[model samples]
Target: MSLTDTRCKGAKSQEKDYKMSDEKGLYMIVKITGAKWWRFDYSFDGKRKTLSLGTYPDISLKIARERRDEYRRMVATGIDPSANRKASKLVESIEVKDSFKLIALEWLNVKKSEWVSSHYSKIEARLQRDIFPWIGDKSIIEIKPIEILNVLKRIQDRGSLETAHRAKSDISQIFRYAIQTDRAQNNPTIHLGGALKTPKEKHMASIVEPAQVGELLRQIESYEGTFIVRCALQLAPLVFVRPGELRQAQWKDINLETAEWRFKASKTHQDHIVPLSKQAVEILKAIQPYSGHGLYVFPGLRGDDRPMSNNAILSAFRRMGIEKEEMSGHGFRAMARTLLAERLRFPDGIIEHQLAHQVRDVHGRAYNRTSFLNDRKIMMQDWANYLDNLRKGEDVLPDGFTPLHSMQY
Candidate 1:
């Protein structure tokens, strides 16, 4: 018989479990442990199945009846309530996996092998600080271009235009990753081209004129700093390497006998060779007694375990009364690049190769790091001699180094 309210209220637990049936396959299971649960039994496609409504008093008789009717309505329409429930759960799981923050983190893990530790940290930090709080929890497929622009606009409002541009690029990469992985339909950031104001480019201050460069070199020689810094300053112009590369130089990377300094280029992720000149060799030898035992060629003042701060050379420049508009530690590169091409008349390709720049060939292929090794070695020594002459205010037009106007390609 169908159940009623009085019968359910007076229902008692027996020695074993028993069920009180209701209309249309709905029933209540009563257990000896004093627990009661609502259950439904039905058939779909000629196969019988069961669905758990919920617990007894918590689901109550009235609610159980209502839910059972709802399921019966669905079953009458040729639907399987149990299968539909499972499908809904699967969709929820997929949604959680496809959230913007989770997918972005997945993309970051895939890129960790290609990026340096510092580069990875910067990307991670930017996402956490700027992107995560904005739309990180939203589904990647649902994120619109306007939402991303709002995040970038926040950064631009703070006057970090370049950072805003970078943040946009980073978001675009994440969205592209989502598209490739089939989690998203499109990259919202792709349509945002030319949306932000371009940041003004600021060139590193440098002394390009030969006469001014000569004066700058004379002052660097007289820098009143630590002995190791003095030696680094002396070698900076001769080698013209990036300041970070110079300060982080290790004795193991230098072969005194061969006059070569080899290390992986931080920006390009390739092996680079810096041909050491006689003057550069002398400076290295002089500093070896002090920093040779440590991992860094120029160890920090506080401890030998760490390399010198990248600002050491710049600070020395300031102390020498060289204004930021006049020269910087990186200025040595600009100075050498200018004079080498204009005064020394070296080919642009050879000079760019010596700078460890990623120059392309006529066919648009990148030249290898070690390209023109022999010519670079010759150029290194000649550049060193030229610096020596400049320090003494001597004529810079050395023989055998023809001007570009008179040379053939």
Candidate 2:
């Protein structure tokens, strides 16, 4: 029988527990103390489970029937109401799931494996330095396009337009990756290309002129920077290897007798042999006394095992009053590429090969190994002496020289 408020007074003093049906599966349990509670029973996967609805008048007969009927409707659709209830409660507990910061970190961790050590450091630095503090905590699914634009605008306001653009692209990639993995629903950066200001095109960097190269060589000769770095500056234009490969050079890779410094270029991560000139070997010999015992040919001042700081050579240029745009440590490669092929009339293939550049042939195949090594050995020596004589103000330009277009810079 259905119990009413009026009937409750008559049964209030009963000394035994009894049942009052709210619906088929849900009922009121009236206890010996005349206290009333609700209970629900259902089967899932052939196992019966009971759920506590509520106490007394709190879950009234009417409300208990409503909950019971809702559970029955869910069961009719082949869904387990009990499991859904548990899942809903668990989801409520984690209200911040699929957040931007969470997905970004997951993205970084997954991509970290594919990157080189230096690249990993650069990407990690970008995320930690710029993106994390702004919108990282927001749920990625909840973040709108305007919020992403706002963060990028803030980065531009701080005078880092390039970084802002890069960061925006990186963030877009993260979102896309997240979508692929089902961590996020949408990429906020898709519409950002039109909303953000377009970046100006940047030109390829090259030196000003061969004369300035001579002047810069003179400045390098006079630079009172770290002894190791002074050697690096002297060798930079002569060898014209990538800046990273130069810094990471080790003594084991060089044969002073054979005049060969063989190591893997960082960009290609492939073995390359630099046929050192007498001047280059001499420069190596000078630094060997200080760093011969250490792993790095140019060990840093602070540690024996560490490579010389990447900034040491560039800082030396700055100390010698070379402006950033006027010249750079990497600019020496430009200096050599221009002067050797244009001024000295070295073959194009020989200069590019000596530059350690990955040149693609007309058929899209790479250079046959050792195409320029023998010639480059002579060229490297001649290039060294040519710079030395020019620094001393000796007229070293070939007779009847009409400077080629590249020879100017």
Candidate 3:
């Protein structure tokens, strides 16, 4: 017989715990302390298992029967309510494990070496500010394309269209990484093409004219700042490496006698060689007395064991009456490339390789292979001497300069 609400409610607790049956595995337990509980007893695989519902007036007869009926259907379908509940909890925990934020962070750590430190910081910042708050906890596989579009739309709505595009690209990359690592099934970002406004392409400021570059070099030669910064200013044009890479240069990577600086490229994390010219070797040797003991050749202004400030080189340029529109820290590369190709008559392939760009050689070979280090050594020395002529306001002829190869290191 089915139990009535009044009988269940009026039922008193005895000296020990006891139960009142309702119907078909549904029953109410009345404890010795007068507490009551609703339970469902069922059999799965010929083994009886019990499930908890709730208490007397709190659960009531009507709600308790409804819950019991639901469980009965689950059992008829061969599902154990208790085991199903546990599986759901496990699925929920797994979902959390594969959440968007968790996967993105994992992707970041994997890319730590491949990306420039400044670029890595920007991506991390964008993920935290734009992507994470909205759907970070959502399972990567479950995140829909529309959800990603909404996140980018929010960024675009704030007039950060460029940032929106970058965020989209980053998210797409993250999804691709997730797929590669078996964390996601598809990339939603591929479907999001043309979803955000395209930002105008603005190249970094640089002065390529010979006369202007000459003056810039002259100013750097005469910079009266800290000796460390002055040396940085001196080497910027000669090496023409990325500013971050220049600042983070280590003494261990340099061989003063052999005149080469070897380190991993900031963008690709690939091995790169910068054949130091006679002038470059001179400047490094001078700075060796001050910073050779430290980890970084240009240690930070503060007394920590860190690289020099990212802005140290650029700031020195500004202090020398150079405006942002006039030149930037990255301008040194442009200055070298332009002068090398146009004025110095150097081959495009050699200049491209020296810049550490992904370039295919005349035989369709990549820059990493067929380094042309011997030709590059001569170019470095000639380029250095050309600047010397320009700084002295002399008529610069890059070809007329004596090649360093003729002289032994």
Candidate 4:
């Protein structure tokens, strides 16, 4: 039977600790010192476990039974109530300190594997330089929207509107993470969205006209640079991957026989596949004798351990008479996107996958890297053949397509 208040109050201390039984393994032990303690014993996974609910009078019979029922329900569902309680205590301890910096660092630690190293460094630097100095030690729960706005205003005050926007996003991310972890109730950054000034748009300079593209391809052939850089330049137009991804290409990620270069995309964190053309494969084969020993396809001049410097392609562009206003290392992507969309009239959905940009399925079904793999392989070969014809100064425009020479992108 459940212990009533009168009986529990009337129970006296025994010669030694003795039990006053209640229902469902809940009971009270009266010690020789007149101390009363409530406990619950239950079998879990074929092993018995005991839990100290609390002392009587301090806990009261009703509250102790309620806690017992709650914990029993947890165990019935295959949950370990003891381990769950310990985890709750840990979160509570962290919540008590409530340091925004501590929580933000926790968030970053959880997020480090998702972001590329370069992108992760930028985010860490932004938080350290802009947000941490002002409110690092402050309680995240108490940080008002106005306080967040002031921090963003300081970033904007220094003419960094873009950084201000990024800071706002970082703050929101932390607040949401805090909410998931039972720390913050609301996100302050959500209220300050329309308050900050929007930064101006910028697009990378690129040559998209077919004739100009042909001329640019011819100029690439005449490059008198290092053989490593030369091979990189040759493959750039064919693959049209981001400069960073191109330079950081690893040998293990490539399959020459299969004609594919697979890697994790730096921007979207997606498993991206770049189908290599015969020409691209040939360029890699040619450079294999020199750089095949290193980790990166394009190893830095300083050492074989490091990939080529970020500026290597930019410096090579300048030396080849390619001005920033005319074309950049990133411009190769824009060039490919334009020609593929306008000249080839390839489906934007297929092109988007090749560009490693996220696109949802029309039916909202699940899809993976190999989605539309055959079409992309065909497009890759077509693009390679197109570039070769352009470099040869041939007007090999396919009939029934948009005129390529007049339009500018």
Task: Give all candidate RMSDs, comma-separated.
Answer: 14.6, 15.9, 13.9, 10.7
The lDDT leader among the candidates is 4
Q: Which regions of candidate 2 deviate over 4 angstroms? A: 1-98, 106-122, 139-150, 172-198, 201-208, 255-258, 267-272, 368-371, 397-409
What TM-score would every model get versus the actual structure? Answer: 0.69, 0.62, 0.71, 0.71
Identify the superior model by lDDT, candidate 2 or candidate 3. 3
Which of candidates 1 and 4 is the stronger one according to lDDT? 4
Tell me the spans in candidate 4 whose CA falls farther than 4 Å from its real position. 1-96, 364-367, 398-409
lDDT of each: 0.83, 0.74, 0.83, 0.84
Per-residue lDDT of candidate 1, residues 1-409 (tens digit): 9888787778899999999999889999999997888899999767789999998778888999999998888676544667555534434344555678877776776577677466799999999899988988788888998999999999999999999999998999988876765567888888889989999987899998878877888997888899988888999998888888888888899999999999988677678899998899999999889888989899998899888887888888888998888888888899989988888878888888888888888899988877878778878888888888888887476545544434332
Encode model 3's per-residue lDDT on 1-409: one tens digit a residue. 7898779879898989997888899998899999999999998767788988977788878999999898888667545567555434434245486788776776676577666577899999999899989988898899999999999999999999989998998998989877765677899888987877788888889989888878888898889999999999899899999988899999999998899999888776678999999999999989998999888888987863888898898789889989888888888898898888787777777888889888775687666733789889989999998998888887567656543323332
Model 2 lDDT tens row, 1-409: 6656555445553567887664467776778877777888887547687777787677666777788888777556544565555434533234565656666665665566566467678877887778777777677787888888888888889888888888888889988866765556778788877776777876435574766766777887888767888888888877888887788888899999999988877767656788998889889989888889889887788898777888887778678876777776677787788778766887676787777778767788887547657677777777777777778766386333432323321
Q: After superposing candidate 3 on the true structure, give the runs of residues whose Cα lies further than 4 Å from its correct spot.
A: 1-97, 109-120, 398-409
Evaluated at residue 395, the lDDT of candidate 2 is 39
Instruction: In angstroms, give how far residue 38 of model 4 lies from its true place.
Output: 33
Report the C-alpha displacement of residue 64, candidate 3, in angstroms.
37
Q: Rank the candidates by lDDT, best first.
A: 4, 3, 1, 2
Candidate 2 weakest lDDT stretch, 10 residues:
400-409
* Candidate 1 RMSD to the correct structure: 14.6
Worst 10 residues of 1 by lDDT: 400-409
Worst 10 residues of 4 by lDDT: 400-409
